[model samples]
Target: MRALIIIDVQKDFLANGFLVVPEGEKVIPVINNINHHFDVVVATKDWHPASHKSFACNHHEREVGEIVEVNDLPQILWPAHCVSNSDGAKFPEDLNTKVIEKVFEKGTKEDVDDYSGFFDNGKLNDTGLHDYLQSKGVKEVYVAGIALDFCVKYTALDAKALGYKTFMIEDASKGINFRPNDVQNAIIDMKVSGIRVIHSRELEKVFSGDY
Candidate 1:
């Protein structure tokens, strides 16, 4: 069976929000259109605490975009977005949440940051996503959402490592691109790790039994 994973399509990552991903809003329509094609659709959210260590504001000396070590994992200091129960943490109003079968919340721990839907950055704790997918008999996963270079990339890589056939819906995702070529490098890394990167249109053919 195939599953569709929507990674962090929250308000904080969209335009007019903190830590905005360039053209992030553009992926929503594509995601909505492709969601129904998969057998199961799951969504992941970065439900962090206000004092989460990943937030740059929590560290006095560090600034947003700065890197620091938290719980032995290299963490990027972001602008305190996606606090639990906050508007920023909620999925955008336009996202087709009705099609999502399960919603997995990650990064709830105040001490560690979870960039992957499957596990925390340290790999010490899982968000229960892998087990859930396995229980559902999901053999292939198609991922799409905001910030392709970060959460989406990590999730796809973890899925591949966990023995699932992973494919990244390139056009259905966007990235922050903090550094030059960050998005491109992420795509290369994912491909190198055996994740198939394809556009949403290509996936449409697969869903329609034309591929």
Candidate 2:
């Protein structure tokens, strides 16, 4: 079976939101159009507590884009965006949430940052996404969503590591690109790690059993 994993298409990542990823909202229609091509559709959200340590506001003398250590793991300080129960943490109104069979919430721990849907920053805690996919007999995963260089990239890498055939839909995602060429570098890294990078248009071939 195949699954489509949509990662962090929440309002917080939109252009008007707190942690805007360039052209992030552009992926929504693409994701919605591809929903029916997969056997299962799953979505992930960054549901952080108000005082989560990943936020730059919580750290004294630290600024956004600075690297700090959280639970001994290198963490990037970001503007507070996806606080739990906030509007920014919710999926955008345009996303087709009805097609999503499961919605996984991550980064809930105040002390840990979770950039991957499957695990926390340290990979010490899983969000149950792996077990869920295994239980559903999903052998391959197609990933798409906002911030391709961060949450989307980590999720796809983790999916590959867990023995699933992973593919990232390039046109169906966007990136923060905090630094120059960050998205380009992330695509190279993901491809090097065995994740096939494809465009959203190729999904039609996949659904037709022609790829």
Candidate 3:
């Protein structure tokens, strides 16, 4: 069956919040429209801890946007965002959450930074997102929401590797920096990795009752 994966459409990613992505809130209406067309709606949230190493605040001498290697993975130091139970961590109230059957919380552990909904720092950890989706018989996934360069892009790539036919709705996503090239690069990466990248308008033709 086809599932809609909404990645980190949270208040923190909005215009006035910390770590806001440019025009991030604009994708909400598009995501809402897409959610109704799919059978299963899976939403992911960036539920990080205050001491999460991915945050620059946790690094004594590091500044935001600095790249540091952690566990052999390149980790970008971000402004403190989406700490668990904080206002920034909650999904946007404007988003229609009723249709979301499953909610996956990522980046909970202070040690690991989870950009993908399926795994933490590209590894399977405490989050049971993959198993939950498998239990629901989800085979093909259509992804949308938040920053295209980080969360959304990584999630799409990981979904493809997990043996699911993945698609990212281009128009329904926005980038962190107002960088158009990053979005274009992500589209290329998705395509080369065998993941489909299409505009939101094309979703109806691509997504039918069955995969």
Residues 1-211 of candidate 1 have per-residue lDDT tens digits of 9999999999999888887999999999999898878898999999988999999999988899899988788888899899999999989999889999899999999999898999998899999999999999999999899789999999999999999999999999998898999999999999999999998879867667675
lDDT of 2 by residue, 1-211 (tens): 9999999999999978999888898999999998898999999999999899999999998999999998899989999999999999999999999999998999999999999999998999999999999999999999899789999999999999989999999999999888899899999999999999999888778667687
How many pairs of residues collide in each model? 0, 0, 0
How many clashing residue pairs, candidate 3? 0
102 in model 3: Cα distance from truth in Å? 1.5
Q: Per-prediction TM-score, please?
A: 0.96, 0.97, 0.93
lDDT of 3 by residue, 152-171 (tens): 99899988999998999888
User: Which prediction has more favorable TM-score, 1 or 3?
Assistant: 1
Task: Report the lDDT of model 2 for residue 85.
Answer: 91
Q: RMSD to native for every prediction?
A: 1.3, 1.1, 2.1
Instruction: Give me the candidate number with maximum lDDT.
Output: 2
Worst 10 residues of 3 by lDDT: 202-211
Cα lDDT for residue 181, candidate 1: 97
